[model samples]
Target: MERVPLSVLDLATVRAGHSSTDALLGTIAVARAADDLGYRRFWVAEHHNMPAVASTNPPVLIASVAAQTRTIRVGSGGVMLPNHMPFVVAEQFAMLEALHPGRIDLGIGRAPGTDQMTAAALRGVSPYLTVEQFPDHLRAVLALLGDDRIDAGPTARLRATPAPESFPEVWMLGSSTYGAQVAAALGLPFCYAYHFAMGSDVDRALELYRSGFQPSPRFPEPYPMVSASVIAAATTEEAIYLAGPSRVMVQSLRTGRLGPIVSPEEAADLDPELPGTQYAGTAEEVVAGLDDLIERTGARELMLAGTVYDPATRQDTLARIAKAWGM
Candidate 1:
């Protein structure tokens, strides 16, 4: 089989002893590297009230990264659509598309990207929203983006301003079969969050997406992507050591105690178990694992999310992965 295109997903992780500013800077550096390496896309994630993650506002970060790099499609790995009005999301991405032209993606997700209380604060209301409303929210966003006609309150006939002739590509992001079904039903691209959903039946989700897919003007065929956590180093032992901090970060998140990502030494003390979503090994091992993942999920694209304590190590991981994949 032909090798699939590789992409990147970054959380702009704030490591121990580092400020959020440092993490954001590191993100730009990573974006430049990914662009130079010929990666297909560079995506930033959104998370609120999390000290470990610095990418709370994906559009702002996307603008910043897009300014620093000339290529490598910049976008939200996704924006949690439930946290804001669909109109605002549409305007923001429309502006981004107008500025960047053919290099913007608007990956949308249903999760709040934070705890219930924090989500309520972000949404400026009591927390009552559910993921079941995602399809409606998505449709509203599309309508505002000029894909459909919806009654605009007060300004009942206005379209989202600066709506470029070419709009950003929209991809649905999810960790469950429901997201797959929604993407297939809507005829949009689907990106499975395999990096975070360690135990999810990704193959089944992709199969469901393919089986239920209905062709639409935006997508003539199903375009499926899978995101994974990877750590590629010179050797398997070194890779495991390099992945220590990420393991600790995952454990903290799992336990609802998310905080600054720790150093390798601190992570070593915790000795957290490696999550199934993560693959920490030599470049060859990572390549083999990625091959298996592609075969199983039949994903046309692969997104690598590597959150390590050191920016240099993270860059090295990307470099090694790119070389192994011959990108």
Candidate 2:
């Protein structure tokens, strides 16, 4: 019966400029506002080679966001594991845990996080998008965060220290059943990307997770995090008015246009099919759509990404959404 925690998923879009600094400042401001408004966490997504989003390195962005806000957890909705070495990720997150103390989390994904072109640039020739190496990679990351050894020979004795006896809370991020099984087998919290991988079968994926769960040191019981898209507006009409530009961007994404995000004025006039896809409407309705997701999925958290362009309007929508659930 606990009310859900309100969180942010920043895709690092600049509200009014075209520089990384613009994106950084906007992100910091969003985090600060969310913190002041009593939200729980502020997370950044990882999308390599995407011009619209500047937060490719979540730890670096998390540090920046944490520095600006006195409270509020900051983390990666996930760091794609297939593109990097597990030990290095553990080290990076360990450093974050050191800097932020109890506010860091390390959500991991098995995908390459990009198309074939960007994937090749980031990972060279390694093939991690396949299901075969995913479980091993997940275990490797956990082991590196613990007392376990990474290298096996006499010269391979590497230990990650200042481990807090526990590091950042690790969550498995996925859009399919494969992610559920891996999270269950490893006994970590699982988060579903119902936000982008929209479908009716996510329930089945959650089922696979709960049924196969086994307790580990990190979690004595299965913990789930459900992620969904939100575009909260004051009057349903006004919310739609403010959400226009982002809707066009979503349209561009689906049509392979990948153009610059259109202005809000342009978006407000477009039809639903032209906007590509979304979860729009008033805050009251968004909560209703998310209600059974929390209960049925056994989610310990809900990560809502408000995909709007204007920072002021976006923050306003977030606060009202939090109040919608009485948070």
Candidate 3:
């Protein structure tokens, strides 16, 4: 089988004993490691009002990561479109593309990335836009980035400045079929949130994307990428041990009691079977699992999303995976 390109998605998770600054620094360290290891892109996530996640603003984090790394693409794992105006999103990413031409990606999603109250706070009641308006908003952003498909919208009267010499690579991010349909109709790359959804509807969604796709100027072919959780260690036992914290994190998210990531020992004691799908094991085992995932999903790229308590250990996990994957 052909080798699939790999990328990294970081949440800048705040570990139990660390401050937000530490988490941010740790993310930069991971970006540098990914750059050196030849990872295709380094993307940061946006989650608001989450005590465990520090990446609330993706454009700012993208700028920081881009400044600190060389030759690695930097972007948002996504910026949730419902929380901000399409023009603002376009301008922020356009400026980023101008600063780091050919090295920026503008991943967009429809979810608010936070609880309802927080989402409401982000977008006030008056003049509020519904989630159903996401396609229009997405088209606005695309048109602002110079996509010709949307030439007569309100955005046509405006431009996202400092108009980049080249536009950022735009991707649609979702865990289900809504995003797939929109991306297919618009002819944009689609990234399935397999890491978060744990493979639910992934195959069906990708199939829907491929079958319904219409060719856009920028992307003539359907590009489906899977974002999955991964953990690599010297031994299978060690990898499972390291994945404990993520298990606890997922449990917390399910129960709405979000908190900082705890130590694996603490996590093991808290919840033994909190569900998640991770390609966790020794490096070779992880590689095999990833190959199987690619075969199942027909994904052209893989974006690994692994969160651990220790930042250095996270970097080591990525390095091990890269070495085993022969990248």
Candidate 4:
């Protein structure tokens, strides 16, 4: 099988004993490690009003990561477009691309990155702020970035200022066929969120993306990527041990009790049988599992999202995965 590109999706999780500042620093360290290890991209996730997640503003975090890493691409694993204005999103990423040049990507998602209450607070009580409006919002963002004239009465010819020499590579992020269809129709790269929500029919979604894809000026062909949770260590026991915290953290989020991610020692008491999306084992085992996932999804790139509590452990896991993949 051909080797697939490896990337990272970091949420900047705040560990139990650490501050949000520590988590941000950890994100930079992880990005640097991933860059040195030959990872293709380091993408930060946008999560709002979540105590455990510190990456509320993806563009700012992407800028910081881009400044710290030289070779690896830096961008948002996804910036949830529903939470902010389309023009602002376009302008922020335009600035990032202006500073980082060819190393920036603009991955946009339709969902709100927070709870319903927080989402309402972020978007305000606007009747037009519905998921159905994502396509329009996305189009507006693209127009601003591409310097295309808009049809709005007052902002007809408005363009996002400080536009880079080149636009950041745009990607449509989704966990369902809706996103696939939109991305395909728009001819942008699509990223499937298998790490968080693995929809029942991922293959069908991919098929829809490929079948409906139309050649665009920016993207000539379909490019699909999948993000999955990975936890690999030198030993199977150690891998499982390190993954405990992530398991607990996921459960907390799912149960609507968002809090700081606990230490592995603290997580040991949680139910061992609680289901999780993570793949945890030795390097060889993890590689096999990830290979199977890639094969099943037909993804050209794999973005690993591991929420290990310790920064050092997280970096070590990424290094181990890189070595196993022979990157």
Candidate 5:
């Protein structure tokens, strides 16, 4: 069968309480496995101080994961741009592009990637980085990466050697309409955070993006990618069981209950059952959801993220979903 290009988002494991080092190493293994399985992209999320997530440093992790795999594309599900200096981002990603060549992606977001306290820790005395500065930061980063300035930095002097003859593909990651607008204005590919937000007006968001899409030096046309929260298993019941912890986590975010990630078993026991859930189902059901999503979002590419708990099981779930989607 021909391969359907599917990308993965690694927060990386959903197993509530493992050590960060272990989870990080495990995600590398999973990426290697997914690469071997012909997965399209393996992207890591930028989450700060989240006890449940191990991918705090996307660039470092991207390098590690990229070093461990071949063929599969690796990039950030997002690097919260508001937290870092754009030139630094350009330099780091340029390094990854140099090393990996033709296999790196740079998906960016406007949010701080954490709550106030955690944000303070990362930024420390720096003025709060808000959404307003996002566009400027984005422009600056791209300029450093692609612009031919008179006095370019050392890296920029040579168009940053090994620059793939092109920089990494830049994407805007959003959970709301503003992000859609920004991505559209830049004409770059947009990836929605349907995985967590389970947004109510998905269609409206897409409409905004397509309608506002303006060609930039970065994106010349409208290209959209979507990421979703999918839990696939042999059966609906099994998947739900696996999704227990994550469901609780989502509900926690939805309801303002915050802090550490709970184990799947703990979540299943504590939360009982989720109400009005969005991403829980069997392979067949999830495939149906993806089809509905494609029509509703008008997405050119779709990536299912936060899909499974265990590394091995995650691969199995993707394999099954790929078959079901006829990809």
Candidate 6:
């Protein structure tokens, strides 16, 4: 069988001793490495007021990464639909598609990527749609991007502006079943946040997505990608050691006190069991884990997400995994 394609989801993690500039540069470096290593997609996330994450605006980062890389697809891990108008998102992604042509993707999510107060600031009295209205907004974006199946209602008269000959591929991103249902009904590709939810509801979400999938012109069949936290090193012990910062970060998040990602040395004293189900081991061992994940979830693609503090180590891990996966 052909090897399953691998992708990456990077948060431009800011380390304890590194500046945000360093974090942004690290993202570019990783994207370059992924592109050179023959990865399929490289997605950046959007988070506001998070010291550890520097990928605040995806389009800007996508443009930068796309410009630097040669072949890997660049896109948002997600742009929270509730945080911006459909037209606004459509316009940004439309422009990206025009510039990058076939190398752009627009992944949409429902929840705001930040606190409610920050979300309010992002909406800025523009009559932001509630989370309940996300499906409607997603449809509107699709319509603006030329998905004629959508009625678009009042959004019909609007255009994303500077429309291109092609549109960016749209994917629904979620950690729960609602996103799965929406993506299936709309006939769009879906990416389950398996890493964020710690492997919860993944089987149910993917099952629903495939069973209820309705084909659309852009996406004729169900395409599901599972996001997983992974770390690959020369030895299982080394991989576990490298995962220290991620464990600490997860613990901090659980306590509602997110902070900059600390070095592994700094996180040595923290509890090591709070993080999600991450694949951390030698390349062959990690590949076995990924193979098991594929068998269990039946995902077409896997988006690897590792919160390692050092960019060089992160890039190295990707290379190791790619080699092991024969990509």
Q: Which stretches of candidate 4 lie over 4 Å from their true place?
A: 126-128, 147-156
Q: Show where candidate 1 strays beyond 4 Å.
A: 130-132, 149-156, 274-277
Q: lDDT of each model, Cα atoms only?
A: 0.88, 0.75, 0.90, 0.86, 0.76, 0.91
Model 4, range 74-109, lDDT digits (tens) per residue? 999798988888879888988998998899999999
Question: Tens-digit lDDT track for model 5 on 1-327?
Answer: 232356888886435555777778878987987787677899999987665677888999999999999899999989998778777788889999988888999999988888778766676634365456677778777667785432344434434333556678888888889889987876778888877777456677888999999886656778777778777888888887777766677676677766555666777678745543366678889888877877777777778776345676677777788678665
Give the lDDT of residue 270 in candidate 3.
80
For all predicted structures, in order, the TM-scores are 0.95, 0.90, 0.97, 0.95, 0.88, 0.97
Model 2 ranges with Cα > 4 A deviation: 15-17, 128-132, 147-156, 161-166, 269-278
> In order, how many clashes per candidate?
0, 0, 0, 0, 1, 0
Q: Candidate 1 on 78-127: residue-level lDDT in tens?
A: 99988888878989999999999999999999888888989888877755
Tell me the RMSD of model 3 versus the true structure: 1.4
Q: Candidate 6 has which clashing residue pairs, if any?
A: none
The sequence of per-residue lDDT tens digits that candidate 3 reaches over residues 1-327 is 569899999999999988999999999999999999999999999999999999999999999999999999999989999988888999999999999999999999988888778888887742246477887888899888888878646657888999888999999999999899999999999999999887489989999999999998889999999988889999998898899998888888888888999998898788659654387899999999999999999999999998788888879999999999888
Model 6, CA-based lDDT: 0.91
